[model samples]
Every structure is written in structure tokens, then in C-alpha cells.
Target: MLQSYETLRQTGIATVRAQIRSGGYASHTAGLGRNLLQANLAIIPQEFALDFMRFCQRNPKPCPLIGASDTGNPILFTLGQDIDIRTDVPAYNIYRNGQLVQSVTEIGDLWTDDLVAFALGCSFTFEHALIEAGFELWHIANNVTVPMYRSSLETVPAGPFRGPTVVSMRMIPEERVEEAVAISARFPLAHGSPVHVGDPAAIGISDLSAPDWGDSVPQPAGHTPVFWACGVTPQAVIQQAALPLLITHKPGHMLITDVPDTAEIPIITNKNMPR
Candidate 1:
């Protein structure tokens, strides 16, 4: 029975990667690996590596650099022990001249000697932390993708990278807003804390139900909508740049890492709320 539980626990991650490698699964990867760290994928030519690295350094909030590969290499050693960039992710978006041209399951045909891959920290890491802290994540409960919106806020630009920051929204009960804030703030890499809360339209979103990407979850009754910086921001910027060729993991289908989640959270406060 003990071994059975272990197998069940790893099933989601293993099955998803297997399907992705076999071309059986191709869709947004939300709520798939609930406990593991899921990463946002970004692949670029070696010609733009130094400038892009500086861009991430300038705007750490939206583009928290998690792991980077050597020039002309696709294998990310820091993320996974045996991660093959060509077939590990569930879906791949191919862009040319900054326009999305095709979406495929793998990019073995497109792998080149002058390419570099970057794995950025994703919000799913904090979602696991939130769940463990007893907060109810609406998207996970309802089995839908978290709502994402393009915000008016602009990131610090570098070279050809410049665009509005994209944020992911979650509906939290009003009473637990402070608790949610305290829990998420611990993760500085995966977009720590809420950027904006309360009304969606306040951040330039005209309608709460219609998100630019992913399915919108119902805010309902007494909950307040909260937003955080998302990993998708880099993808948006890349699309706007219109490079000759670029690739990224499909939204939600992240690259799982070998790094333990606890390594990211150093301090824990049990006071609940200050008196």
C-alpha cells in the first residue's frame, strides 16, 4: 500500500510527460502537476542570449530566471536530471518574425546548434504552497485554467524586449486575503504577492469573464479577485519582437524540476495574523 501511494503521487507528472513525448496530449497544462514546480519555457538563438539575460535581470518580477542552458544546447541540467527540451514539454509554440506560426508537441526537427533554452519560475509553484497553507484555489477546484490578462503595467525594457506585463488572476475569499498575501510573499522568484486586488476593471480588464488567455473562473459571492505577475510575460514579449524563430512550452504545460519546493520558502510564520 505504501508503494501504491508513491506510484499514485507520481502518476500525474509521469503520465503527462509520457503523453507529451508520444504526441498524445496537446493542450494548456493547468492543474496537472499540483505539487511539483512547473516552468515557463523560452528558446532563443545564441545571438540574443546576452541581451535577453540582461532583460531578465532588469525585470525580475515578471521574468524570474530559474535555469539556463549553455549556448547551442537544449538540455536543461538544473531543472531536471534527464530533461530533453525537444520532447519534455506537452506543447510547443513556434514563432517566426514575432508571429505565432505553428504549435506542435515536440521540436526535434527545429533543434539547432545556435539555440538556447531558458526555464523561468512559474506561478504553479506558489499555487502548491497556497494549497498546502489551506487556501482554496478556485481554478484547481473547478478544473479550469487560471485567468490571465495583459496589464497596463510595463516591464523595464532591454534591447528588443518591451511589452506590457501579463498577470494571472485568482479569486480568494475576502477574509483570507491577508493570509493568502502572507503565504505567497514567501516566494520571491515565482512572482511573490498580489500586485492588484478587488476589481478587475481597475487594471484595464473590461470584462472579468473574457480573459486574453486561459478560461476564466467564476469569482462568485464573497470572493475578491487577486492578480500576480505571470510567466507568460516573456512569451508575449517574444511574440511582439517577431524573431525569425522562437519556441516555448504551451501555457500550463510546464517543465517539472528536480528542485524541492521547500528550498524556495525559507521562513514560516505561524502567528496567522498580527494582533
Candidate 2:
């Protein structure tokens, strides 16, 4: 059976997708894709697509839209030639009426032709940039998932989608904070720079040792927990909407896309985005 991220590290995107499709690797995808851009998956019906897209528009920091699919289509032509929303991800979370129903490795049976998949920009590339610049990510080094928290920061609501902005924390040393910001700023789709720095209490995060999602990471001696607007924010917001059906990538198990981190994607902002 296929195993760890390391085992699939050398494989290409197609191979990795195939591995996940086989249900042989349902694991956290923190450091696997190298320089490849990763995306958070949100599959909803066409009936909710317009509102959801507007939600992503009003709240770009957490719900940065990168790629999207048409109604009744599983293929995100921009992300990959053969990307399928139903089985490309390592794991999926099913929600009904704003409550989690179950987690599945694949959504083949739950998929409907009316579903539209949205691929939002994720921070894997930003984390990669940090590592390339000599900043160490504790979760990546320790082989655990990054710590994520549901912050007190409210998102700009669009229709039924409204929730606190979720953030992922990385412990950065005192001196490297500026350097981290500069590197991350280049990737606007990666949620821009650090949303919050130092003192988790300011953001209403009560505990550094306890995260709302993913594994808890220790706060090293001189390092401070720097929070970034996570792509998981949309999933959190969608859950509260209590839609009849909502499907999302299991937290930390993102969909690895073929797009390179350095690729110059179109500057898409503002609510006037073309459908």
C-alpha cells in the first residue's frame, strides 16, 4: 500500500493524485508537494455557487479564489488537465445543515452533477518560501500538522456564509518576522503577509498548546506564533450556513495542483470578477 508523504514526495502530481484516489494515502499534506501550489477544495451546488463566489470575493484574505469549475463539472481546467473533485483529495469532510456528517477518503458516491468545485489558494507555497529563506516551520520539521485556530476576527459576510476567520500558526523567531513578511508578500494569493504576530491572546486564541484543528505545536523559547489567514476559513464559514450539503477537503489534507508557486496568476480581486 502507498504510505507516507515522503514515499510520494518524488512522484509527480498525477502519481500523487492516483495514490490518494487509491485510498492508500489519507494523510496530512504539509510538506509533500515541494514548490507545487496547493489548494483547499470546496464543493457546493450551482444553486449556492454565486453566493459562495461572492463570499470568497468579499473575503479574499481567507478565501482567496484561485481556480473554479463549472456547474456539473468536476474538472478545474486551470488546476490540472485531469483533476477530479470527487477523488483527487486525500480525504473529504461532508457537512449537512452546518454540522459535520462524516469524513470520507473519497466523495465518489456523494458527488452530484450539479456540484461546482472551488479551489482556493493555500499557504503551502508561502511556507515553502519561508523554508527557502531559512525560516523553520516546527510542524513541518516535526512531521506534524500546523496548528490552526478559529480567531475572533469576523469575516465580511456574503449572504449565508459568515464566520470567524480561521488562521494557521507558525512559530517564527523574533528576528525573522520582517523577513517572513517580505517573502510572503510576493504571493498575494497565498493570503498575503502575516495576519497577526505575537501574543495569541490579542486574536482571542486562548492557548498555544491547544488548536481548534490540526495538531498542537509547541512554542519554542524565543519564537512567537505568527498567524496567517488560512484557506480553511471558507470551510468554517460554509459549515455555519447549514446548507443541505457541503463538501470540503479534510483540514490539512489539501489538493496539490500542478500550478507552480512562482507562476504569475491573473490579479483577480474586487467583486467584479468575471464568471
Candidate 3:
């Protein structure tokens, strides 16, 4: 079983698809690939795709656009050669009128001809970079989900999509805060850089122990909770928008793509241009 775990960790897109097809693995995709990109999934009607795309463009810090599928197609060739948006993710959340209606292992029955799939860069990609740069992550070490909060900062509105920016918090030792920032700053697509360094209440979070999503890990002595813009922001915005129908990967159960984690850097060359 340990070898099977290791095999899944090292497996590529094809192998993962096979496993997901066989119902052998149905959990969060975290820690599965050492250097592969995992993505946040958002599926919406084709009628709303353009507006959502603009929303993402306007709010790139929280909604970085990584890969988008063609209209009415579940295959995201740009993200991976054989990617199937419907079943690629480990788990999915089905929402109707902005309320979560069900959690499913796959969306084959829910898929429709008018649906459009989106693949957004996730901060998990940068977590690997942080670890590679010698920064320790508390959640990975403690085996807990990274805590996420809805920040006081508001995202720029585009169409009907507007809401508070949602951020994921990580506890970093005092000495390594700079290293964490420097490493994460290199991946803007994956919500690069720290939005807040200390004091959870500064960002509208009343208590660090309580998070809107994910399990909270205890902050150790001499460490501060560092926050970063998260891909979950879009889900929050969609909830607020009260869209008639929406679908997303369940929190932590991300879509693993064939895209190499090192394929893109987060640095912005044109500051004036939308990210």
C-alpha cells in the first residue's frame, strides 16, 4: 500500500486518469506530484464564460487565469494533452443558485453541452517551490488543510462577480518569512507573495482558530501566520453572485494536470496589463 502511494505520487496524467477512472483514489490531490501543477476547477455555463473570464482578468491576484477550455467541451488540451475536465479532479462540488447542493466523485451526469470548464493556477504549486527553497509548511507537516479566510480587501468587480478576496494562511517561522515570500513571489499565477504577515484580525478574521474553509493548524511559538491570495476566491465570488448553476472542485480536491509546475514563472513584466 505504501508502494501504491508512492506510485500515485510519481504517476503522470495518464496514470492518474486511470486511477480516477477505476475509483481507486477519491481524495484531495495534495502532495501527489512533487513538481506538477494542480489546478482549481470552475465549470459554468457558456453564457457566463466571457463575463467570468473578464472577472478573472480584472481580479488576477485572486483569480489568475491559467487554462480555459473551448465552449461546450470538457477536454482542456491546453492544460494537458488528454485532460478531461469532468472526471479529472478527485472530487467536485455542485452548486445551484450559489448554494452547494452535492459533493460527487465525478460530474459525468452533471455535465452539459452548454458547460464551460476553467482551470486556474493554485497556490499548492508554490507550496512545492517553498518547500524546495527550504521553508517548512505547517499544514503539510501536521497533515492538516491550509486555513483560508475572507479578507477585508474587496476584489475589483467585473460584471456580477465581486466579493472579498479570500486568502489561504500558512504559519512560517520568523526566520524564514523572507524566504517564503521570495520563493512564492516567483509564481504569480499561483497567487504569488504574502498579503499579510501577522495578526489575523488585521484582515477581518476574528480568530485564527476558525477558518471559513479547511482545518486550522495550531500556530507554534515564534511563528506567524502568513497569508496569500487564494484560488478559492472565485468560488466565494460565485457564491455571492448567486449564479443559477456553478461547479467547482471541492476544497483541497484539485484537478491535477500534465502541465509541469516549472513551466511558468509568476513575475509580471507588464504591470499596466491585467495579469
Candidate topping lDDT:
2
How many pairs of residues collide in model 2? 2
lDDT tens string, model 2, 183-256? 98888777888899998999999997889998997777888788999999999988888888999999989988
Give the candidate order by descending TM-score: 2, 3, 1
**Candidate 1 vs 2: which has more TM-score:** 2
The whole-model C-alpha lDDT of candidate 2 against the native structure comes to 0.85
State each model's CA lDDT, in order.
0.78, 0.85, 0.81
Pairs of colliding residues, candidate 2: 97-242, 98-242
Native-referenced Cα lDDT, model 1 = 0.78
Q: Show pairs that collide, candidate 1.
A: 29-252, 97-242, 97-243, 98-242, 98-243
lDDT of 1 at 149: 92
**TM-score per candidate:** 0.88, 0.93, 0.91
lDDT per residue, candidate 1, 1-275, as tens digits? Answer: 12222233346666666666676665555555656667788999988877788888888878888888887777776665557789988788899898888888899999999999988878888888888888888777665678889988888888898898899999888999998888888777777887888877787888889889888788679899888988899999888887788899877767776555545632223331122
Q: Please give, for residues 1-275, the per-residue lDDT of candidate 3 as tens digits.
A: 12354467677667766777556777656667667777888898888888899999898878878888778788777776566788778778989999999998888898889999988888988998887777777777655578888999899888888989999998889988898888888887788888889987888989888899988888899998899998899999988888889999888878877667777732223332222
